[model samples]
Target: MRRKYNPYALPPWLKKSRDVLHQFAIPFCIFQGIRTILFPTAFDVLFLIALVLITVALKIELL
Candidate 1:
């Protein structure tokens, strides 16, 4: 008889990270959805501001 391998198991670190990111993404998506409904035009502005801040932080750390 031959043994079978299973793919259901994942590495500890990957599973932890996946759970944490999933939790964070749910709230983030909800917030953005509400913002877009309230102020459709402002939603883009808010997203751009967040993108700029993230890029700035990355650049600062890289320098």
Candidate 2:
């Protein structure tokens, strides 16, 4: 008989960081949407940069 592996199981630190990023990303995305509606030009570039940085940071944590 062969054993199976579980992918959902993660280390404590990784789990915690993953949780934190998930939480942060949600609100940031909401605000970004609001910003897009409220003031599209003022922080257009800034918000794009912030989102990219957040994405890259999360990608590193995923690895």
Per-candidate clashes come to: 0, 0
Give the per-residue lDDT digits (tens) of candidate 1, residues 1-63.
995643246688866765565446545656766777777886566885665554454445321
lDDT of 2 by residue, 1-63 (tens): 985644367688877877788668757867786777778886775786677677666666542
Model 1 is weakest, by summed lDDT over 10 consecutive residues, at: 54-63
- Model 2, total clashes: 0
What RMSD value applies to candidate 1? 13.1
Clash pairs, model 2 backbone: none
Local distance difference test, per candidate? 0.58, 0.69
